[model samples]
Target: MNEPIISVSGLRGVVGGSLAPDVAMRYVAAFSAVAPAGAIVVARDSRPSGRMLASAVHATLCALGRPALDAGVAPTPTVGVLVRRLGAAGGIQISASHNPPEYNGLKLFGPQGRLLTAAEGEQVLAQYRHSGPAWVPYDRLGGWQEIEDPLGPHLDAVLSVVDAGLIRSRHFHVVLDANHGAGGALGRRLLEALGCRVTLLGEAADGQFEHPPEPTAENLAGVGAAVASAAADVGFCLDPDADRLAVIDEAGRYVGEEYTLALCVAHVLADRRGPVVTNCSSSRMTADLAQRFGVPLVRSAVGEANVVSAMVQCGAVFGGEGNGGPIDPRVGLVRDSFVGMAHILAAMARRGLPVSRLVEELPRYEIVKTKMTLQRHRVPAALDALEAHFSGARADRLDGLRLDWPDRWLLVRPSNTEPIVRAVAEAKTRHQAQELCDQAAQVIAALG
Candidate 1:
């Protein structure tokens, strides 16, 4: 069997190929070995393979004499909420997020309802490598229990943070493209509670995708037309686990995942100003939003766990990635698509502006991303050459090689799972951003 992409957070790969039942069992055993001794909450998305993988996970937990609280067909954030709400030792969400249907994986959360920190993840990885599952006698085997209302706590948590009444008063019409992910049920309920007339697409929790599954501009080709025809005020698109969201404007324009965080930060900082945190790879428009609110903006290494760590360290009021996954401590520590939806609705209601106008008012930026294949031995020289070429720009090695200018920036990062280097550049205009990437590409090509 091929190896899955294993990390401290969890592992993901092709369902029956790289990721198999035994792999999930050993991974869960590793988590259970390190996790505090208490009942664990296990939730999953609507993926078809989730059921089979979840059975293996449950069996492993039971063999370890660890109780399992099965939260069937729930989103990733919901697992976090459930873990904390149930006071469990930890949580495991069987999801591949936005990956295609043939893929599946597990995301582990600590007892505090957050992704495991780097230190914690390291211990789990070590445990998985050296020690195997500690199976117990039948008499000592733990049992599983199905959760009755898996979505309730998460819904209440998301609704409580935003001005629900204000959003309801607006009577906004919304088009939610759940894309047959685990979040469809909760997405529909939350939208209706906010008094929005919802036009739900692929709301089933069956892992059957109507689109390419990733909620990107290119993938969500026809969704905007549906929003326009429904005469909806806005459109919301969610990935498989519903942890990430992408937006569509009132004009049926794809506002994209990057603006999801910026718009939320814009609305949140206005209500309660505090430090903001985002990954290094996120758009700089959020930094401008933080400045507009006179709050500090801190950028951490690229990853959701790293962003959460920075948020906790800084006590950030709002933080998220450019991938439409917003983390609001007011809701829960996990990247929450529901919270993003609510806050965006609140922003629209409070500003009394169309989504398009709100997006227009924000600072403009274009980020272009491209990658090149190179041997691992050549990565350093390529990075050095790019850094030397862009000598005038400020450099930061926080996550990768990032070159910063007054109004433009460039990032060249090697992929964690591939023998490739990705170059991302952002500027005032698409032409400028593309030019930056082009320049970096030329420098990297020189190393060849």
Candidate 2:
């Protein structure tokens, strides 16, 4: 059996092979052990293994004398909001996110309804490694309850962030590809609330996807066609867990995930005008939007928790990653597809422009990503060589070695779980970005 990919957020692995009930129980026990004794919200995506893992989490929470509030299958962000809405101590989302169907995992949340930070995750790991969970006595055993209205509060929160009245007046024709994941439940409701004439693909919340689960540009060809053929105002494609959203313009262009954060930031800054936060790997389009608004843009280390921490520190009105995850503090700390959809539409309506035009108004950059197989021990040497090779460019050693030019930048970082080094570059042209990535790859390879 392969080992699960355990990280600060949670653990993911192929079901039965690496992630079985025992492993899930142990991880859940570790989470419950560290969490304060209160109602813990448990939710899952539409994966086939979700029920088994969710049951394991529930039973473990109960056995540990901590109440478990079952939210059934829902998006990852919905679980976070539900945790806060219900005032639970923490939450667990049984989802592998964009991974293949065979993979499943647990996503743990802190009391304030956010993913655990690096320090908190380190504590969880230490507890899991050194000592077993501290179980409760029979007299102090916790209880269990089920909540069916998970989508209602989430929908309300999303609507609050946007002008629902204006959106409903527009009655935008929209198509949503939920990919048969847990997003369908709240997604459909939120669209209807905004008076969107919605054509839902994969409406059922069954784990079976109509295509590859990730909402990448290549995978979203069919969605683009659907939007154009239907003459919908826009199209929204969500990953299996629905936290990440990729947009399709009204003209049938695959705007991709990177633009999701940029467009949302552009809209919010136009009206609210405050500090914006995103991870280091995010596009400069966000920074450009901040500059246009005369606001400060703060960059955090990659990961939702890190971004949220920075947003809190900077009092950012909006924050997210470049991976199509938009975190609206008005809604919740978690990245929300519904928030992305609402804000994009509201931005379009307020601007009196089409999605394509809105995209064109922002800074344009091509992001190219590549990876090379390398041993973990060689990463330091590779970073040193790359730094020397790109000596003229300004370098940042925050999460990795990032070299920045006037309009281009390259990031070289090692994969936390895989034996590979990830390289990402952005420039005005695809060729330029590719060249940057290739150069980094060669430098890393030479380190051997």
Candidate 3:
């Protein structure tokens, strides 16, 4: 039997291979066993498999006599917002994030409308592994309800964070590439509300992806070219789940995902002076921005849940990961593409400059990411060896072995979603970053 990749947050795998209808039902049953008592909200991206999985989730919830609030075909962040707005006990989003079309998965949210923390997720996983479905009697079965106007509340929340009137007056010509995900619906609404002349791509929520699902530099080349060809002031690209965003300048430059967080931090710090947070894997641009405002910047382990956990602990004003995900506690805890888009437009309007110019104002660095396979048991020894090898640099063992220099840093950590150890390095020069990764990889290889 094929086993699905399960984590504290949720599970993802190829549909028939590991994520079958039974698997979905069983996971939802496990979730129902532990979720807070009340209604549970359900949402999904544009994946073709979403409907099937949604049905399984709904059935499982009904069997457990838990009300299922269905928010049909919405972004992942929308589920988070609805969980809070409707006072639901929990929420489940059916999305594989930026994975290829063949992949689909579930992301669990707690009552606070945020992804489950490591502890909370572990509880659910434990229940999932041990408990069988407790089917309620026929008369006690739960009912289903549809969420009408699902995007309105989320739209209002996003618009409130930016200078809507100022952005409206600028009438910036913008390009949005939703890539046939749930984002296009709200992306169009948000952009139009900000008074931009919008050129939308893949506006339908049919799950037919036009390009690679991930919004990386290589995947966004066509999007950048489209931005240049459209003669727009800027372009925004969203993953299939619309939780992440990538930027494309008017000159067809792919700004990548790191700038999404830095640019938003810059805008937020301009008005509010408070603590900021990001995962360790994020670029240092946000750190520089926080320093410019004389506010503290904190780094958590690499994951949205980890970042949100630290943000809550530190009372952060804004926080997010580097992969085009920005979390504003004001809107919601989930990583929101809409929040990133609105803040970016607000930054552009506030600076009265092109997207590229705004990006140039931030401290610049080159980051290289590489990964290698290693048995789990050997990870600690490898980290110890690395720490000794780079003994001269500042060492941190928060999530992994992180060695930092005055102008560069390297993080070698195991992946939460895969079996490989990911090595990420950032420096003033690309060569330096690549060299660090190469050295680390060699060390791990020799240890193996």
- lDDT against the true structure, each candidate: 0.92, 0.90, 0.93
- What are the per-residue Cα lDDT tens digits for candidate 1 across 197-271? 999999888888999999988998799999998899999999999999999998789999999999999999988
Tell me, by lDDT, which candidate is best: 3
Clash totals, every prediction: 0, 1, 0
Error of 2 at 353 (Å): 1.5
What lDDT is reached at residue 226 by model 2? 95
Clashing pairs in 1: none
90 in model 2: Cα distance from truth in Å? 0.3
Model 2 agreement with the true structure over 1-448: per-residue lDDT tens digits? 6668899779999999899998888898888878886899999999988998888888888788888898898899998889898889999999999998999999999999999988888888887777786678889888988897878888889998888888888889999999899998788899998999999999898899889998888888999999999999999999989999999999888999999999999889878989999998999999888998999999998889999999989999999999999999988999988899999999988888889999999899999999999888888888889999999999998887889999999998888988888898999999999999998887777765
Candidate 2 weakest ten by summed lDDT: 126-135
Please estimate how well model 3 matches the true structure, expressed as its whole-model Cα lDDT.
0.93
For model 3, residues 1-448, the per-residue Cα lDDT tens digits are: 6888898899999999988999888888888888889999999999999999999899889989999999999999999999999999999999999999889999999999999999999988888888888999999999999999989889999998888999998999989999999999999999999999999999999999999999998888888889998899999999999999999988989998999999999999999999999988899899989999999999998889999999999999999999999999989999999999999999999889998999999999999999999877788999999999999999999998889898999999987666789999999999999999999999988974
Backbone clash pairs in model 2 (N, Cα, C under 3 Å; residues 3+ apart or in different chains), count: 1
The local distance difference test score of model 1 is 0.92
**Model 1: how far residue 245 lies from native, Å:** 0.7
lDDT of 3 at 143: 95
